[model samples]
Target chain A: MPDSAFAEIRNLDLFAQMTDENFAALMRGAYVQNFPAQIDLISEGDPSDFLHVVLSGSVDLFSTWNGRDTSLATVRPIATFILAATVKDAPYLMSARTLEKSRIALIPSQDVRAIFDVDGNFARAVVTELAQSYRTVVKSQKDLKLRTSLERLANYVLRQQKRSGEVSSFFLECEKRRLASVLGMTPENLSRAFKGLVPYGVQVEGTRVTILDQGELERFAKPNPLIDDTSV
Target chain B: MPDSAFAEIRNLDLFAQMTDENFAALMRGAYVQNFPAQIDLISEGDPSDFLHVVLSGSVDLFSTWNGRDTSLATVRPIATFILAATVKDAPYLMSARTLEKSRIALIPSQDVRAIFDVDGNFARAVVTELAQSYRTVVKSQKDLKLRTSLERLANYVLRQQKRSGEVSSFFLECEKRRLASVLGMTPENLSRAFKGLVPYGVQVEGTRVTILDQGELERFAKPNPLIDDTSV
Candidate 1:
C-alpha cells in the first residue's frame, strides 16, 4: 500500500488506536485499488467479503426494489462502509458505486473480525461507528417520513450550505437526478421543489445554489439538531 | 429484578454470551419497572442515561419535527431499545413510549459502558446487536423510499400473517392510526390503501385482518427477502 493510503486509513478512528502490530496484520492483507467513475463497487445481496475504506472520491450507497432504485447514502473519503455487514457476516443491504474516479482500501473481512476478537479498542471503535451509522439512518428515516419533497429539498440545501462553511452559495454534491433519489423525489418533483423554494429565497443555477434569505429558509425548513446535525 | 425478566433477557443474543460475572454486574445495576400504556419512555434530545430492555409488552420508537410525528420502530418483548444511543452517550434520536402496559429493564449506561470496557465478549455482542439494528433501519429506509403506501401496507399484512405462523388471519400489532404512521401514511390513506388491496383479497376489520387470497396479496406485494426477511 502507498504510504499516503496507509496514513489516511491509520488516522481514522476505526484504526488509529489499534496496536501497530494488529494494524500491520490488517494492512498486510489489504490492497488499495483505483476505481474509475461510475464503476460498480459492490452489489446488494452479495456476501460482504471485505470492509471498504474510501480513501478518496465518493461512492453512492443505494438500494432497489421492484425495478426501482433510490440513493440511500454517499460514502466519501477516509471512512468505511458496510462494517456492520462485515462484522455480522451478512449480505450487503445496499449497492455501492463510485461517483467519481476513486481510491479505496479493501480489508479482508476475516482480518477485521479476527482483530476485533483480540483488540478491545478496535471492537469499541466498531461499536461506536455502528452506533453513529444507526443514528444517521434513523435521522434520514425521520426526514423522509416527516417532510415533503419541497421541505426536504430546502433543508438539504441549507445543510449543504452549512457543510460548505456556512456560505451564501454552494454546490450540490450529487447530480440533480441522484439528489432527487436521495431526497426520495423524482426529477420533475425536484425541479418543482426548487421552484417552490423561491419564495423562501433559494436560487439554483445548475449545481450552484445561492441562499438569498437564510433566515426565511431556516424558518421554512426548521433543521432540527436531532435530524440535521451531522456533528452529533 | 424479577427472575423471569433476567431469564428473558438472558436468552437474548445481546446478553446470552456475556460471562456470568459480567452479566451479574449488569443486572445488579439494572432495575425493572412496569409502565402503564401511553407513558412516555424517552424523548428525542434527552440524554441517553439508561439502556432499556422490554421484558414484556411493547414500546413505540417515534420521532417528531415541527408539529408532526411518525413511528420509526416498535420494540416488542425480549428485545432492547436505545442501545446505540446509550452506548455512544448521545441523545435519543427518537422518543419512545409504551404501546401497552409494559415490563422494562433499565440498565444504567455507565454500568453497561463499564462492563463493555473490560469484557470482550460483551463488546463483541454489542457490535453484533448494533450491526443488526443498523441493517434493520437500512431495510426500513429502502421500504419507505421504494414502495408506495399501498404496497407497504400490503407487504406489511403478508409479513404479519407469516409472522403469525403463516396463518390465514392475524391481529394488527398497532391500532389503524398508529399503523398508518408506521407505514408512513395518514389513517385515511391507510384505509384507502386497505380498500385498494380488497381486490387482491385483503380484508381489514378493526385490528384483525383476514387474508382471503394469500397468493394474490403476495403477488401484489412481491415481498423480496432482501426487503421483507426478518431473519436477515
Candidate 2:
C-alpha cells in the first residue's frame, strides 16, 4: 500500500469510527490510483464498482440530460463521494472526472457492503455519511426550485467563497459551463447572470471570481439552511 | 401494551432486525395514540423527542413561511416519519399533522439511541432506515428541480395512483391548497393546470381526482428514476 493511501483512509468520515483492525481489513482490498486531469473517473448510468475518495486536487461530478451536461458538484481533497450509490448499490447519478491531476482512494463497493454488515461502528458511520449526502442533495433541489437562475448564481458564489474563509476571490473548482448547468441555466444565460451580478459586487474573471461586497451578495442570495448547508 | 401497538413495530424498518428480547426491551417505553384529522402531531422548530410511526390513516408533513404554508409530503400507514430530526436531535423541518383519524406509534428517541449503542444489528437497521429516508428526500429534490410544475403534478398523480393501485379514483389526502403548495405552485395555478390537462384525460373533482388517460399523463410527465423512485 502506498504511504499516502494510508493517510487518506485516516481522513474518510465513513471509516472514522472504524477500529484499526476493521479499517486495515478495508484497506487490504482497497487500492489508490492517480489520474491525470480530464480523465473520466466514472460515468453516469454505469454500474458503480468502487467508492472514490479524493485525497488531493479536485474532481468534477456531473450529470447529462438530452445531450447537455451540468455540474452536480466538485469533490475536494479529504472528501469522499458516492457513498449513497455504494451503499444502495445503485447506478451513478452523475459522472466524475478529474479537473486536475488527482489522487483518489478507490474502495470496492462490495467490501464496503461486507464491512458494513460485519462491523457495527462502520455501519453507523455509513448511515451518517449517507444521511448527510442525502440532505445536501435535497437542499440543492430546494435551491433550484425556490430560487431564480440569478439567485442561484449569487448564492453559489457566496457558498464557494465562504468555504475558503476570508479569501476575497477564489477560482471555481468545476468548469464554468458545467457550473452554469448545475445552477439550472444555459451557458449563455449564466454568462449574462455573471454580468448582472456586477452590481451586487461580484466580479468574474475567467474561472476566478472576486466577491467585492460579501454583505450585499449574501443579502441578495439569502442562503437558507435548506438550500446551502449539507450538514443537516 | 395494546395488541395493535406491537403490530406497528412490524411496520418500522428499524425494528425489523431486532430479536424478540431486544425488540421488547427497546419498546418498553413506547406508546401508541390516535389523533383526529387536522391534529398537529409535531410542529416545525420544536424539539424532536420521539420517532413517530404512522399505523393508520395519513399524516401531512408541511412547513409554514410568513404565515403561508407549503405541504412537503404525506406519510401513510406502516411507515416512519421525522427519523432525520429524531436521530440528529434537531428541530423539526416541517410540521406533521393528521390528515384523518390516525393511529401513531411514538418511541422515545432516548431509548432508540440507547439501544442503538448496545445492539449491533439494531444499530445497522437504524442506519439503513436513516440512509433510505435521506435518499428519498434527495429524490424529492431531483423531482422538483428537474421537472416543470405541470410535469410535477402529473407525475405526482401517477405516483399516488400507482401507490393506491389501479383504482379508478382516490382521495387527495390533503387540501387542494396544501397539495398545490407541495407541488410548488399557487392554488390558482394548480387549478388552471388541472383544467389544462383536460385533453390529457384527467378529472379533478374537489379532492377526488380520477385519471381517464394514464397513458397520456405518463407521456407528458416522463418520470425519471432519479425523480420518481421513492427508494432512490
Candidate 3:
C-alpha cells in the first residue's frame, strides 16, 4: 500500500486511537485495490473476511430479497463499510457494489479481531464506531416508519442539499431509481412524490433539485434531529 | 438490586465478559424498578442517562410522528435497550414503554462508559452487543423495504411461531393494535392482511394464531436468515 493510503486509514475515527505498533500490525496483512464501476464488492450472506475502507469514489450498500433489491446506504471516500459484520465475524447483511471506479483497502478480519482482543484503545474505538453506526441505522428506521413517502423525499432533498455544502440547488449523487430504492418507494411513487413536493417549493429538473422554499419544505418534512442528524 | 437481579444482569451477553469487580462497580449505581402494564418508561428525545435492562416481562420500543405511532421492537427479559444511545451519550431515538407488569434495571450511563474505557473484555462485549443490535435493525429495515405489508405479516407469523418454541398454535403476546403498529399497518389493514393470509393456511382468532400449514406459509414468506435471524 502507498504511504498516502496508510495516512488515510490512520486518520479515520476507527483507527485514530490505535497505537502505532498495532496499527502497523493490522496494515501488515492489508492491501489496496481498485475496482470498476458496478462491480460487486461483497454479497449478503457471505462470510465477512475483510474490513473494507473506501479510499476514493463511492460504494452502495444494498440488500436483496425474492429477486428484488433496495439500497441500504452509500459509503463515500474515507470511511469503512461492514465494520459491524467484521467485528462480530458475521455474514454480510448487505451486499456492496462500487458506484464508480473506486479504491478500497481490505484488512483481514482475523487480524482485526485478534488485535481488538489485546489493544484497549482499538477496542474502545471499535465500540464507539459500532455504536455510532447502530444509532445511525436506528435513526434511519425512525425516519422510514414515521414519515410519509412525500415527506421523506422532501427531507431527503434538504439533506442532500445540505450535504453538498449547503447549496441552494444540487445534483443528486445517485440515479432516481436508486434514490427511490433508498427512500423505500417505487420509482413511479418517487416521481409522484417529487410532484407532490412542488407545492412545498421543491423544483426537480432531471437530477438537479432546487429548494425554492426551504422554510415551507421544512415545515412539511418536520425533520427531527433524532431521525435526520447524521453527525455523531 | 437483589442478588437475583445481579445474576440476571451478569448473565446478559453484554456483561458476561466483564470482570467481577467491574460488574460490582456497575451495580453500585444501578437500581431495579417495577412498572405496571401500559406505562411509558422513556420518551424519544430524552437524554439517555441510563442503560435499561429488562429483568422480567417485556418493553415495547416505539416511535411517533405527526400524531401517528409505530412499534419499533419488543424488548423481552434479559436484554438491554438504548445501549447505542447510552454508549454515545445521545438522546433516545425511540420511546420505550412497558407492555405488561415488568421489572427492569437502570444502570447509570456514566458508569457503563467508564468501565467500557478501562475494561477490554467489557469493551469487546459492547462491540459484540452493539454490532448484533446494528445487524438486527438492518435486518428489520430490509424486511420493511424488500417485502410488502402482507409478506412482512406472513414472515412475522413464521418468526413468532419459531419464537414460541415452534408451536403450531400460540397466542399473540401483544395486543392486536400494537401488533398492527409493529407490522407497520393500520388495524384495518392488519385485519385485511390476516384475511389475506388465510389462503396460506394461517388462522387468527382474537389474539390467537395457528399456522395450519407451515410449508405453504414458508413458501409465501420466503424468510431469509439475513433479514430475519435474531441470533448474532
Candidate 4:
C-alpha cells in the first residue's frame, strides 16, 4: 500500500474515531489493488470475506433479479461498500464493479470483526457508520415509493446540481442508462421524463442539465429533506 | 411499567447484549405506555428523543408526501423502531402509529447513546442491528425497483405465507388498504393485482389468502434470496 493510501484511509470518517493501535492492526492485514473499468469486484451471494474501501475512482453497486440488473448506488473515494455484509458475516446482497480505473483497499473481514469486538472506539465508529447507512437506504426507499419517475428525475437533477456546488446547471457524472436504472425507470421512460421536466423549467443537452426555474422545479418536485437529504 | 413489559424489554435482541448495569440504567430512564389503535406515536422530522420498543401489539411505520401516505413496514413485539435515527441523533424519517391497542417502552435516546458509548457488547449489538436494518431496506428498494406491481404482490404473499408457517392459506395480518400501501400500490391496483395473480393459483377471500399453486406463483414471482430473505 502506498503511504498516501494509508493516510487517506486513516482520515476517513469511519476510521477517524478508531484508536491508533486498532487502526494500525487493521492496516496490517489490508492490501490495495487497482482494477480496470467494468471489472467485477464482488458478486451477490458470495461470502463477504473482505471490507472493500474505495481509495480512488468509484465503484457501482448493483443487484440482479431474474436476469435483470438495477443500479443501487455508487461508492466514491474515501468510502466503504458492503460493510454491513462484512460486519454481519453474511453474503453480499449487491454486486460491485469498478466504474473506472479504481484503487481499493481490501481489509480482511475477520480482522474487522475481531477488532470490532475488542476496540471500543472502533465498535462505536462502526455503529455510527452502520446507522447512517441504514438511514440513507430508508430515505432512498421513501424517495422511490413517494415520487413518480418524472418527479424523481427532477429531484435527482437538483440533487446532482447541488452536489456539483449548487450551480444553475451541471453535467451528469454517469451515463443516462445508469441514471435511469438508479431512478427505477426504463431508458426510454427516462428520455420522456427529461422531456416531461422541460415544462417544469428543466433543460437537458446531452450530459448537461440546466435548471431554468428553480422555484417551478421545486414546486413540481417537492423535495423533502427526509427523502432527499444524503447527509447523516 | 408493568412487570411483563420490563421482562419483554429485557428480552429484546437490542437489549440482550447490554450489560446488566447498563440495562438497568437504561430501564431506570425508561417508561411504558399503552396506546389505542390508530394513535400516532412519532411523526417524520420530529427529533428522535426516545428509542421506542413495542412490547405488545404493533406499530405501522409510514411516510407521507403531497397528501399521500405509504406504509413502510410494520414493527411487531420485541423489536425497536427508528434506531438509526436515535443512534444518529437525527429526525425520524417515518412516522409511526399504533396499529392496534399497543404497549411500548420508550428509552431516552440520550441514555441509549451514552450506554452505547460505554458498553462494547451493546455497541456490537447496535452494529449488528443497524447492519441488518440497512440490508432489509436495500432489499425492499430492490424489490420495488425490479418487480412489477403484480410480481411484488405475488412475492409479498409468498413471504407472508412463509411467515405464517408455510401454510397453503393464511389470514392477511394487516388491513387490505394498509397492505396495499406497504406494497406500493393503491387499494384499487391491489384489487386488480390480486385478480392478476389468480391465473397463478392465488385466491383471496376477504382477509384470507390461499396459494393453491406455489410452483406457479414462484415461477411468476421468481423470488431471489438477495431480495426476499429477511433473516440476518
For each model in turn, which proportion of the native inter-chain contacts is also found? 0.87, 0.30, 0.87, 0.89
**Model 3 over residues B1-232: C-alpha lDDT tens digits?**
8999999899998999899999999999999999999999999999899999999999999988888888999999899999998988988889999999999999999999999888999999988888888999999999898999999999999889989999999988888888888888888999999999999999999889999999999999999999887874
TM-score of model number 1: 0.98
Candidate 2 residue A218 Cα shift, in angstroms, is 4.0
Q: Given the true complex, what DockQ would model 3 score?
A: 0.81
DockQ of each: 0.86, 0.39, 0.81, 0.84
Against the unseen true structure, what C-alpha lDDT does each candidate score?
0.92, 0.78, 0.92, 0.91
Total colliding residue pairs, candidate 4: 0
Candidate 2 displacement at residue A157 in angstroms: 3.3
TM-score, first chain, each model = 0.98, 0.90, 0.97, 0.98
Best by lDDT: 1
Better of 1 and 4 by DockQ: 1
Off-target runs (Cα >4 Å) in candidate 2 are A64-70, A167-171, A195-215, A225-227, A230-232, B43-47, B64-69, B167-171, B207-214
iRMSD in angstroms, per model = 0.8, 2.8, 1.1, 1.0
TM-score (C-alpha, index-matched) for candidate 4: 0.98
lDDT of 1 by residue, A1-232 (tens): 9998999999999999889999999999999999999999999999999999999999999998899999999999889999999999889999999999999999999999999999988999999999999999999999999998888888899889989999999998789999999999999999999999999999999999999999999999999899899867
Alpha carbon deviation, residue B95, candidate 3 (Å): 0.7
**For model 4, how does the per-residue alpha-carbon lDDT over B1-232 read when each residue is reduced to its tens digit?**
6788888888877788788899999899899998999999999999999999988899999999988889999999889999999989999999999999999999999999999889988888889888988999989988998888999999999999989999999999999999999999999999999999999999999999999999999999988888897984
lDDT of 2 by residue, B1-232 (tens): 5876796675567787877787887678889998999999988768789989888999998765333466777888788888767666666666889989999999898777777777788878777776666656655655564666787888888888877886868877667787787888898999998887778888989888899988887777776666576655
How are the candidates ranked when ordered by lDDT, highest leading? 1, 3, 4, 2
Better of 2 and 4 by lDDT: 4
Tens-place lDDT digits, model 3, residues A1-232: 9999999999999999999999999999999999999999999999999999999999999999999999999999899999998988999999999999999999999999989998989999998888888888888888888888998888898889878998888999999999999999999999999999999999999999998998998999887787788874
Residue pairs with backbone overlap in model 2: none
Provide C-alpha RMSD values for all models, in order. 1.2, 3.1, 1.2, 1.1
lDDT of 1 by residue, B1-232 (tens): 8898888888889988889999999999899999999999999999999999998899999999989999989999889999999899999899999999999999999899999988888889999999999999999999899999999999999889889999998898788899999999999999899999999998888888999998899899999787888877
